[model samples]
Target: MQTPLDTLQHIFGYPSFRGEQEAIIDTLVSGEDALVLMPTGGGKSLCYQIPSLVRPGVGVVISPLIALMQDQVNALNELGVRAGFLNSTLSMEQVRETEQALLNNELDLLYVAPERLLQSRTLDLLDSAPLALFAIDEAHCVAQWGHDFRADYLRLDVLHQRFPQVPRIALTATADVRTREEIVTRLALDEARQFVAGFDRPNIQYRIQQKDNPRRQLLQFLRAEHPNQAGIVYCLSRKKVEQTAEWLCREGFNALPYHAGLPAPLRATHQSRFLREEAVIMVATIAFGMGIDKPDVRFVAHLDLPKSIEAYYQETGRAGRDGEPATALLLYGLEDVVKLRQMMSSSDGAESFKRHEQQRLTAMLGLCEVTSCRRQVLLRYFADTLEEPCGNCDTCLSPPETWDASEPVRKALSCVYRTGQRFGANHLIDVLRGSSAEKILSLGHDRLSTYGIGRDLSAEEWRSIMRQLVAAGYLDVDPEGFGGLRLTEQCRPVLRGDQPVFLRRDIKVPTARPAARRAVEEIPEADMGLWQALRACRKRLADEHGVPPYVIFHDATLRAMLEQKPLEPRQMLAISGVGDSKLERFGADFLDVIREFEYTHS
Candidate 1:
């Protein structure tokens, strides 16, 4: 019988288990349940994959992502694992064939969508077959308040009820404290052992800027830092996704737009292109990239603010999954917040849900305006601790200046109050800046005491103060009216002049890309030639296999080949990603490349 570690090294070709993977695998292999909250690129799949290989029968994985299931099975089949998936993408004949494989115990792992898994025919088929253990990928989807909620997931507890003997493991890349609790309760995993690795992705550098000419800023960031690299640019709406993608294409980029409103076939084709091709920028709304397995996505840029930190983390995490240096950039305007809040206010959710969502949005706004380390704030939100400030964020790289806004905040608040606390930021700024607009003159005789009180400051300066005041809890958006500003109870002290208030002053980053600590992997000229050769070979093989290039062999694996320059078959087996199957299948082709390079260079 192969042990879990033996299966890992022999089949998966990983020399060692990462983080708590070995422990999680042990729990599952011993017929116990487990809940895992590991970050992206943290090797969550191996926690269940190894146990399935070591145990009897096929591992039944319940996932909501059809594309993810297909991608994983393709990658697993390459490693000589007998993996199959049952999803809508399959034809009726293919589904029956996959089902037969599971029943015959010919498959080591089987991926099924939550809807398909809940079907009575599928459940009955599973009843007749022996089972290793159930693995629930994206377990957070079971939570009602999760970012990617699936109604079918709410019925997943039936798995525990149906198969009381089979061990189960639930895994997700990102889930906050509330969502974690919800998953546990929803999935009936009360007795399961939980393994939570750190939420930090150190390879990703976080950068957020104010949305000043957002398209221009995005273009500048892309051209300067990640030219011709594979990345995803997220937009707030379908319209913006289309516009941004078209504009990027016009500016000489291979960009594609993806949103739910598009035809399903078109979305699938766009996603397929993004996965298969190089240097493709996917401009998508939140509708895309739930379970994308593309490993070489170099950056994730947000043209507008995300709904909350969890959504932001989940989206940005799509980049740098291969543990290479990547970037997460966000450019947002205050209007984004107002529009989001209004949308939330008008949603059909219950009051409690609205309140919780409001809190999350408040925290997100605070992150956008914070002067301290953005990574630290992000980790704290997820109930993870980073004792020291991470130096890989915008604030850490170029710390923002703080100004004592005691007097200015008081004026901003006074202006809101004097305007009956029912006017929006623009109106308040106009009143504070002493604007003589027709509407202002029409509303009053222009004799009010608070009129023109803030004339000493520029309109932009006054607008910044109002924005900060709303974000800092000194003022709140009035839900009763049309995006008006009202004072909150938390602002009583500052309003009474008892305590001081300080705010971070927004500073524009230089257009020239700084030679800062933002990780940039600079390949030497000598290694570039061999690296290109290895990549070309992989791309050629991937096209033949009808899968993504990363599915064939990750960039890291290719780089290992370049660095080691393996000569013989046995030397190729020493590579990190080379299992028995890959060595027998692809060892010769890669070794041939290495030999040619050595002969030419020597």
Candidate 2:
């Protein structure tokens, strides 16, 4: 009778549980429902995975992404966990084979998409099999209003209604207060105990810049910060996704485009290549990246503004999933706001929904303009608190300067009012900067008092003021009217000359400079050879088994082995992520590589 700790160590090769994992597992192992809100790379899987193994029967996992499901099943099979997946991606024969495995109790865990799991055939199969528990991965998709909403996920409540006795756990890496409540209501997990882990991913360094030639800015960030590193660059539109991918490739990066518009087979092929290859940059739209489980993504760069903090957090969380130091760079501008607002307003959703989306986007802009720690603002959105600023973010790294923008804000607001609020930011900025453009001349008579009063500030400066004013609710974009600027009720005090407004000083993007090369994990020169040899061995094995190299051993785990220099099976077993099955299967091979390296060096 192995205890849960024993299973965790002997099977998973981890010495102990991380942050609230043990308690969550304890509840689930005791046959209780639990809703888990953990950050990416926060060990959310172990909460249900451990319970599945410790409980009476096979664990049924409802996964949203087929690729993610396949990856998990592959990694688990490598650990000798007897895992299998049943999804549409599989052939009829493959599905039947997996079905047999489930019915025969040969599998410890089975991963299925929400739609597949809800099928009558699948439900009947599960009803006959001895079930351990139900695990819903990426449970945030259950919220219909969420950015990553899936209609199929809305039908998953039947799992509870059908398997009433089996304990269930619903998990998500990104969920705010509203999304969490939706999950509880939709999943029928209200009675389930809730475990909300801190949303901070300390390993990720946050950086946000006002968009200045966004494509070039992205190229600079990649060249300086993440040369040859595996990363994802998110664009807001499909055309941008394709163009960026093509541009990055021409710039000599291994980049590929992914979006819903791409052929399904092409998208699958690109995703497969990204997961398996090193230093592959995936340029994609918001349509991608919901259930990506890759662990070694070094950066997640945004070429446009994400609609909300939740979307931003979820997208950026894809980076550094292996708990390594990673970077998240966001480049935004006034156009992003105006364009997003236009799209939202034109959407067929109800007015209330549009208003809600507008609020969410406004919050996202506030985050972009934040002068304090990025992590602090991000966490506060999810109702979590960090005691102090995370020193890794751009704000904490190089704090921005604040200035009294009351005069400029007042001028910008007056320009909007005097122009009949019919012009967008570009035209409004032109009016303020006294541009003699034909439209400005034809529409304005060049006679307004506010015109040319903004000559003291640059055009970019005026644009920043208007954007921030909108974010601060002192102004709003009339989405129904071609994204024209309009004064909000909140602007009354400021416009009336009764209040002063301050804003972060917006600066122009700096010229691109060569980045200083960072030391590779600070590994000593002497051990570098052995590290390469270990990687080669892992890669060879991964190729032979048709799995990603990380599926053999994560870079972090390999680094641990390098540091520990394990020379025997018992010593290898003691390494984190070197579970019993791994020790039995490949411990000797890895130990031989280590021992031979020692002999050669000596």
Q: Listing every candidate in turn, what is its Cα RMSD in Å to the true structure after a full C-alpha superposition?
A: 1.4, 2.0
Question: Model 2: runs farther than 4 Å from truth?
Answer: 510-520
**Model 1 misplacement above 4 A:** 514-518
Cα lDDT for residue 118, model 1?
A: 93
lDDT of 1 at 185: 92
Candidate 1, 92-183: lDDT as tens digits: 99988988888888999999988999999999999999999999998888877767889999999998999999999999988998888998
TM-score of model 2 (CA atoms) = 0.97
TM-score of each: 0.98, 0.97
Candidate 1, residue 54: lDDT: 94
- The Cα local distance difference test for each model comes to 0.89, 0.88
Report the lDDT tens digits of candidate 2 across residue range 446-539. Answer: 7898888888888778878887887788888888888888888888899899999999987766654212123238778889899899999998
Model 2: how far residue 167 lies from native, Å:
0.5
Query: Backbone clashes in each candidate structure, one number apiece?
Result: 0, 0
> lDDT of candidate 1 vs native?
0.89
